[model samples]
Target: VGSAAVVFQAARLESVPDRVSTLPEVEIQLFRDAVVQVQEEMKEIKERMADVLPAEERALFDAYVMMLESETLIDATIQRIRDGNWAPGALRHTIEENARVFEQMEDPYLRERASDIRDLGERILARLQSSEQRRTGWPQRTILVGEEISATQLAEVPREALAGVVSATGTGSSHVAILARAMGIPTVMGVTDLPVERMEGREVIVDGYQGRIYLQPSERVREEYLRLYEEEQALSASLREHAAEPAVTPDGHAVPVLVNGGLIADLKPSYVEGADGVGLYRTEIPFMIRDRFPAEEEQYQLYRQVLEAFAPRPVTLRTLDVGGDKPLPYFRFEEDNPFLGWRGIRITLDHPEIFLTQIRAMLRASEGLDNLHILLPMVSSLNEVEESCRLIEQAWQELCDEGRRLVYPQVGVMIEVPAAVYLVPALARRVDFLSVGTNDLVQYLLAVDRNNAHVADLYDSFHPAVLQALAQIADGAHHAGKPVSICGELAAVPEAAILLLGLGFDSLSVSVAALPRLKQVIRGFPLERSRALASEVMQSESSAEIRDRLRQALIEQGLGGLIRAGLH
Candidate 1:
C-alpha cells in the first residue's frame, strides 16, 4: 500500500551565478521589489509556522526576517547593486561576505550561525532567480527526484501536483523526510546510482516501504503493479469498514490500538476512530520544522490544542528528542556517534531551562484535563529519570505558584535503548508506563545502523535476542503493575503486532496507515493462539526460522493473507 509508480521529473535546482556587473536604476528597483516580496512572504511563513511549529522554532523565521531587515546586510546589497552588479549577484556577494566572516569566528555557535546565513542567502537568491524566470508548468503525475530536497525547495513543490519523491541520499530523520510524511507523500530515499539527470520526466515506480524504484516497467511489470495497487485498495477498503470498532479478538480480548505522530488529524478519515489516542506525540515536529527551540508559550499552545482534541483519552507527549540524526539549526554538536551522544533526556537534562519550559507548558496544558502524559525519550539511566522527575516537579510547582491550574500528569520513559530494556524493571517502578521504540531498540540491541543501507538486512526486529528483550521489558513492566505499550514502527507490522500481543505488550501504537491492517491481524487471531505463537517465536533460534514458523502457522490458521499481503 505504501507504493506508487508515476511518470516524474528529475527535479534539480538550477544553480544561478550572481555576476559582478553594473546594474541600472530599474534593475535596482526590481531587486528592491524582490526583497520586499520575499519579506512579505516570510511574514506569511512565520504565521503558518506558529500554528504548526513550536515558538522557538517559529523564531527560526525571525532570524530570516531580521536578516532581511538588517540595515547592514540590506545596505551592502544595495551598494553592490548600485556599484554596477546584478541584483541577484549583489545579494549573493553580500551573503558570501557574511558567510566568510562568520566562518572565521572563533566561537563554535557563532561559526554555526554561518550556516543559517548561507541558508537565508540561498532563499534570497532563489527568490531573485524566480523573479527572473518563474516556473509555470509542472508535468502530470510528477515524482520529484533529486540528491536532496531542501526545506525551501520542498515548499515550492505544489502539494497537489507531486505524486511522490525519490532521493539519492536522505534518512528518515532528515527534515525532508519528516515533511514528506506530513504531506502524505510516498517517498523512498537513499536510492543510489541512478541516472536521474538523463531520466528526468520518466515513468517510475517508487516503493517507499521496500525502498525500490522501478525505472522503466514492461507491460507485464506495470500490470502486476497495477493489480497489486488495486488489491491494496480493496483490502484497505475492507479494513476501514471496521474503523470505529475496537481491536478485539475472537476470544474477546480488547487491545487498544493507538496511532503515533504529531497531529491527531494525521489519523483522521480512516483510522482515527480505531485509534485509542496518541501513543508517541513526537514533540520534535515543531523543532524539526523550525530553526530553533520552541518558546514556552508557543510550545504550550500546540500542546494544549492536542490535549483538548483528545481530551479524556491518554495522550503521551514525548519531550524534545533531538541531536544526532535530528539536528537543530540553532543547536549544533560534534559527535563521533550521535545516536548515543547528547540526545533525548540528555539534551533536556543538560539544558534544564529547555526541559523546564517544556514541562511547564505540558503541565499547564493539562490545566483542567487529565489526558496529558509526559514521556521522556531515550532514557537509559536512573539518574536521568530522577533528574527529569525533579524538573517535572519543579516546573509543575512553578506553574501552580503562578496560579495556573495544573495536574501532575503521568510520566513515562521510552524503552529504545538496550540499557532501558535492562532497566525497565527499575524504570517501570519510577514511571507510570513504558513504551518500546523498537526502531531504535532493535538497532541498539543488534548494534546495527538501519540508516546504513548496506547492512539494513542486519536490522532485523525479528531477531531472537530482540524478541527476548521485548518479552523481558513487557514482563518487567507488568510485574511492576505499570502498563507498557510499544510505539515503534515495528509495532505496526501485522506479524510483529501478533508477536507483540503474544509477548505480553499491554497495548501497541502504530501509524494510521498501519492501523487497519494491525486491527485485522489482532482480530484474526485469538489471544491464546497469539500467545502460543509468541511462545514458539521466543523459543526459535533465528529470525529466518521464526518467520518460517509464523508463516506456516498463519496459513494454517487461515490468516496467510497477512503475510502474503506484505503486512508482515
Candidate 2:
C-alpha cells in the first residue's frame, strides 16, 4: 500500500499534429543527426540498464537498438523525409505499420511489444524536435499514472521520488509491472476505468497488493489504510527475519519452496535467499531476446550461469516453451488457435534441429553440476514423451561421444494440458516427476482464455474442476512413486499454497516476490490442517465457496494479513 500525488503522463507524440512537409538540406541533416543521437542514447540506456535490470529485461533495449540500426527503418524514414515528408511523421508511420502487425496478433506478449515500438518512436521524435521531452516536476512522493506505462517512462523517474504506479491498461505480467516488482514499487494495472485526465495532483492510495486504487478517500478510510500500510510494512520485516528458514509445517511436514525464474536477477542474493532452487527456469527468455536463434555455446553459457549459481540445488530447466503468448520474432508462424496449436513440445518436436541443439547445450551445461532437470512442456500423448526421451537420449549420446563425461538429467512433463492430467501415471512411469502449470491447466480445462479481459473473470484456479484435477495429478504421480509440484501463479498465493500442500503437492515454486510470504504460510500452517482444509475445499460446489473457505482458514489462523484486502 502506498499514497502519493498522482502525475498522469500525457501522450505527447499523439498530441503532435501529423503532416508531410518539405525538408531543406539542413533539415534533412538535422534528422540524420537526430537518428545518430537516438542511437547513442539507446546504447547508453542499454549499458546503464545492464547493471540495474535483469538480463532478460535489459534485452528489451536490444529491440530499440535493432530499430535504430535497422537499414530498412533508417533508409525508409530518410527517403520519406527527403520526399517532402515530416521526419517524426515518417518515423511514426513506420512504427505504427510495424506495430499494427503485432497488435493484430492474438498473443498478449506480442501485442505488448507494440507499445515498445511506439515508445521508441516517441523517443526518436523528441530527439528530432531537438527537445529532451523529459518530465522534471515530480512531487516528493509521486504515483506515476498513465493510460499505459512504458518501461522507459518508469526508468526515467527518480526511484527515490517514485512511490507507486497505476496504468489504465496492462496485466500483472506486463513489462511495466515486472519492472515495478523488481524495484519494490507498488503498482496497480489494468484499471480500464481510471480517469487519467482527472487524476493529476489528486491524493490517491495505491493498494497494489489487492490491485486497487482509492482516489480522495474519506478520513476513516484513510486512517484504516494507514493502519493496513503499517501492518504490511511489519509483515515484510517479519518475513525478512525468517528468510533463511525452511518452509516446514509445524507438524514436521517439509515443503520445499522454490522460485520460478529465468533472468540473471533471480540469481541475486535477495532473490536466492530462502529458496530451495528454481522450479521452472524458463529457457525461452534468452531465445526471445535475440534476433536469431542463440548458438549452442551461448545457450550453454546462459544455462551454466543459472546452474552454477544454484549448484547442488536442482534447477528444473524447461526446454523452449514458446508460442502462445511468447513468440520469437525471428521464427514466426500463424495458427487459428495458437494456444492449442504449435506451442511448447509440439514446436520443438517438429524441429528436432532446434530441440537437439538446446538439449545438447543443457547437457553440456550440466556436465559437472548434475543439478539440471529437463522438463517437457505441453505433453499430451505417451508418444510425445517417448519421442522427447528419444531426442534427449540422442543429445546425451552425442555429447558422450565427444569425450565429455555427462550424467543424464532427470526428465519431467508439465501437466498443463487436460490430456496430460489423465496420463499422469503413464507419464510418471517415463519421467522422474510431474509439475502442474495451474495457469494453463485452468485455462485449458475451463476453455477460457485467461488473457482475454472479457472472459478473464471465468478463469479461476480454485474452481472445483481445477481442484479435482490437481488431486488426480497428485494421486497419479504418488501412485507411480513420483513427486508432483505446482509452479504457477496459484502456487504463489498463501491461501492457495495451503490448498496445494493439502492437495499433496510436494513443492511450491513461485516468483521471488512471493517466496517469503509462501514460506511464512508453510512454516506457520500445519500439514494436517492444510489437508483438512483441502478436504473441505473439495466438497465445495463453487469457486466462490472455495475462496471463502481459504480466506476463513487464513483468518482463523491469525494470518488474515496474508489475504488480499479485495478478498476481505
Candidate 3:
C-alpha cells in the first residue's frame, strides 16, 4: 500500500465549516475544471458506445455532457445572490433546470437524460467534498473518507477495489443503497459519527446486510464475516439453480409470474427470468427516457417491438402516470403535494391529445396481438375511469373510421388511493379489471412517505387498515365481475403473498429476482389456511396483532417454520 491517506467518513457538509477553508474561488475553478474533464470523458465514451446505443440514447449521452459543462455555477450563483445568501438547495435547482430540459425532450432515450444528469451532478459534488476521492493507493490500498455516501457514487466505484462503504447520510433509495444492493458490497449508511479518518489503511469488516461497520475488527468478527459470506454464497447458488422453475403453490394453485419493466434494458432481465408476461409496462418510462416526446411512428415501432417480443403474453400498458411524487420538470405541475395532484387518469382527462397519441400508438402496436391491456393509474373518481374508457373507445373508433388498423386493449384502473378503493365497486362497474398499487395504497392509507426512512417503518402494507381496504377493493371488483390483481412490492414478499391470495387477489405481480422465492412460498401455501388466516387478520384491531397473528399462522402452517429457517 502507498502512504496512508486520511479518509473522512461523515454526512455531507452542505455549508463550509469555520475550520475548513471557504475558498469560493478555488471551488469554482475546481468545478469548472471538473466540468471540462466530464465533457472530454463523455465524448470519449460516446465515441466508443455510439454503435451500441440507439440514436436517441446517443443524444442523451451528449446532453448529459452538455449539462455538466453548461455553466451551472453562474446560474446557481445568480440564484444565491437573488436570495441574499446561498441556500443549500440552490445548486440542485440549477441542476434541475437541465433535468427539465431533458424531461421535455421527445425521445425515450433522451428522457433518461434527467436521471443521468442528476446522477452526474451529485457525483461531482460528492467528489469535491467527500473524503473518498478516486482510487489512489497501491494494491491492497488503504483509502479514507467521512460520513455516508450517495448510492449513485457507490455504484460508480469499483466493487472489487473498495474494501467497504461508510456513509454519514443516506436513505434506502439514496445512491449508496442502490449501488450497494447492485454490487452486493458490504456498506453502512447513516452512521452519523463514525471516525473514518482514523481507520485509514487499517483492517475493518463491513456487514452491509446488517447495516454494521466494524473498525479494527477482532479475529472473531473477521471469522464470522468469512463464514457469513460463505453462507450467503451458498444460498445465492441455491437460488440460481431453480430460477427458471414455475412458481406453483403446494395446493396446486399456479399464479402467473411476471416482471415490471420501465425501460427497454429492463426487458433483458425479464426475458432471462422467463416472466410469464410484462405485468406493468410503465409507458411513462419511454416518454421519460427520451429527450423529447417520441414521434408517433417511433412510439408505435417501439411498442410494436415490445409486444412482438412478448407475443401472446399479456402486457398491461399504464398510461403516463406522471405528476405527484414523479413529476416531470418539463410538464410543470405546480402543486404543493404533487402526489395528490393531477396524475394518471387525471393527466389524460386534462390533456386528451397526449392521451390520444399514446393510446393510438398502443393500439397500432397491438395490431396482431390480443394480449395487450390498458391500465389507468391513481383513479380517485368513477368519472376518471369512465372518461378513460371513453377516450380509448374514441381512439379506436377514430382509427377504425379513418381506415387505420388498431387493436382495442382491455381497460383497467389502479386502486391506489383510499378514494379509489372506496369507489372501486362503482369504478369496477365500468373498467374491465383492477390492479392494486400497494406501495401507494399503504402510503395513502397511513398518510406516510414510503420513501422517507424516518417514517419508512411506519409504511406497513400488512397494517390491518391497509389489508381491509385491499380486501374491500378485491371484493368489490369480484362483485362487479372484474379480475383484481396486485402489482406492487408487497406482492413480492412471501408473507404478503399469503395475505393477497387470502384476500381474493386473482393475480400477484412481482420483480424478476423475487419470483422463484415467491413461487416457493406459493407452492407450500395452503389456500384454505391462508383464507382462514386472512379472515382472522381482518378482524384484528392493530397492525401488531395482525403481523403477529399472521406470522404465527404461517408458522403453524409450516410456512413460518421455513421462514424461521431462512428458506424464504
Candidate 4:
C-alpha cells in the first residue's frame, strides 16, 4: 500500500572509457591516498556485511579489497607514473589493459574475473573523481531507476534524498531489497518492460508494495498518491509521539506489544519505537548471512548483546529456521516441495551438533538473567520439542560441568505448520509458551505460497481456518498455564492486530514501524468489543467477508482513521 511520487535518475556509474578525453593535473599523493582510503572503505564494507550479507556473498567486497591491495596492480601503476604518464590516466590504462587481457582468456571463470576487475577499477575511478571535486548533481527525491545496482552503489545511496528505488531486475531476497528495507526506502524490483528510458523527468508514481509505477500519472492518480504519502508521513509522526505509552486497552487490560526480528543493529530503535520486548529474535539471520556456521563464541556474543540490550525486557530467540525457501549454500539438497521439506526444528533435529551449539550458546548467554526464551520454529511433532529440550538439559549440565553458573531459559514452539495446530495441546504441555506464526500457518493451511504471484491472492491470513487455529493455539497454551503470543507478518496490520488481541493472545509482536498505529488501533477498542469482533469473524466462512466485517467493525468501534490512513 506504500506509494510515492518520484523523479527517475540513472546512477552515474559509467566506467572510464579506453580513450581518455579529459586531462586534469592530479597529484600522485592523491592517487596513493585514494587507494588507501578505498582499502579502508572496502574493509569497513566487509565488516558491515557481517550484519546483513552472508559471508560467502561478501567475496564481492573481498575482491575489491584484493584488487586495491594487489601488489602487481599497484606496482604497475607506480611504474607507469614514474615513466611520466598522468596518474589517473596511467592507473586507468593499466587496469583496463589487464581487464582486456583477462577478458580474452578462454576460461569463462577468467572472463568473469575480468568483469570484476573492470568494476573495481570504475569504483576507484569514481572515488578519485569525487576527490578531484567533481560532484554528482542528483535531483531531489530520486526514485533511482536502474537496470541493476551494485552493492557498493546500493550502500552509498544518499538515503536522505531517496524517494524509492525501481530496478528492472531483482527478487525480494536480493541485496538491493535488503539494503532498501534497512534504509526504510520504498523499492520495487523485478519490474519488466518498463520504458524507463523514455520516461525520464516525467512525474511517476512508484508503488513498492505493489511493484508498479505509473509514468506521467493522471491528475487523479497524482492527487491520490500525494494524499497517500501525506497520510503516511503524518501517521508516522503521530505514532512516534506515543512511542513511550503503554499499550493498554480502554478497559485497563495490558497486552504486551513486542517487536519481531531484533537483529543486532535494530534493537535500540525497536525499544525507542515502544516495543515491550522481543517476541521473536530470529536467529536464522546469523546463519543465513554467514559463509560458514558461526562458532559457539560468535553466537554467544550476539545472544548476550540481545539480552543486554533489553535486560529485564524478555527476548525470545527462535532457533535456525532454514532449509525451506532459505536453503543454506553449505547444506545443498534437493526437495520437491521445500516448504514442507526439511526446515526449522526438523533440520536441527537431524544435525545435532548444529542444534547443540546454538542451544548451548543461548543457555550460556542467559548466564545470570532469565530473560532469554528459546523458541522452536516449524515444529510439527512432539519429538522435535522433546529432543530439543533434552539437548537443552544436556547443555545446562555441560555448563555446570564447566563450573559456569547459568539460568535456563524457557522453551517455546511456533505453531506455523498446519500439523502444529492440532498438536498445540500436546505442544503446550512440553513447552513453556506458544506463538502462532500466522504468516506460515495461513500459507501451509491454504496450500498457497504467498511468494507465488499467481497464488498470492489466495494466501489469506484472514481465512476462517486461520482464525480458528489461532484461537485454538492460544487457548491450548492458556489452558496449560502457559502464555501465548502472535509473532508474524499478519500481526503488523492494524485491523489484524485488533482481531488477534480479541483472540485472547497475551501478546502481539509486529514490526517497529507499525507499533504506534497498531497500538493506537488496539487502544481504541475495549477487550470485550475486540472479543465480540473476533467471535463475529470466526463465525464467518469467507475470507473476504471476514475482512469486510472486521473493517466495518473497526469503523463502528470508532477506529476508522486507520482505514483512511491506509493501514492495510
User: Which candidate achieves the best TM-score against the true structure?
Assistant: 1
> Which residues of candidate 4, in runs, are more than 4 Å off?
1-204, 208-212, 216-220, 269-273, 564-568
Which is the winner by lDDT between candidate 1 and candidate 3?
A: 1
The TM-score between candidate 3 and the true structure equals 0.68
Worst 10 residues of 4 by lDDT: 2-11
By lDDT, the candidates rank as: 2, 1, 4, 3
In the order shown, the candidates' Cα RMSDs to the true structure are: 10.7, 11.6, 13.5, 10.2
Model 3 residue 85 distance off true place after TM-score fit, in angstroms: 26
* Cα lDDT of model 3 by residue, 331-403, tens digit: 7658767667777778878988888899888888888787788889888887787788888898889888988
What lDDT tens digits, residue by residue, belong to model 1 across residues 1-568? 1222122222112223334343357667776777777778888999987879999888877778888889767889888878876676577678778888989999997898888887776666666565653344455666776665555455556666766777766655344665565555667777778555445546877666566778777778787777866776687788888767888999999999887877535634454567788898888867766777889899989998888777778889999988766677688989999877888889889889988988888888888887888999998899999999989999888888999877689999999998888898899889899988887888888887656645666778889998989899989999999999999877766678888888899899877667777888888889899899898778889899987787677677677665544442
Clashes in candidate 2: how many?
0
User: What TM-score would you give candidate 2 relative to the actual structure?
Assistant: 0.73
lDDT string for model 2 (84-123, tens) is: 7566656766777777988999999989988887887777
True-vs-predicted CA distance for residue 54, candidate 4, Å: 41
Please give the lDDT score for candidate 1. 0.76
What local lDDT does model 4 show for residue 451? 43
RMSD of candidate 2 to true structure, Å: 11.6
TM-score of each: 0.75, 0.73, 0.68, 0.70
**Could you give me the TM-score of model 1 versus the true structure?**
0.75
Off by over 4 Å in 3: 1-230, 269-273, 402-404, 552-568
Question: Which candidate number maximizes lDDT?
Answer: 2
Question: Candidate 2, which ten residues in sequence have the lowest lDDT sum?
Answer: 1-10
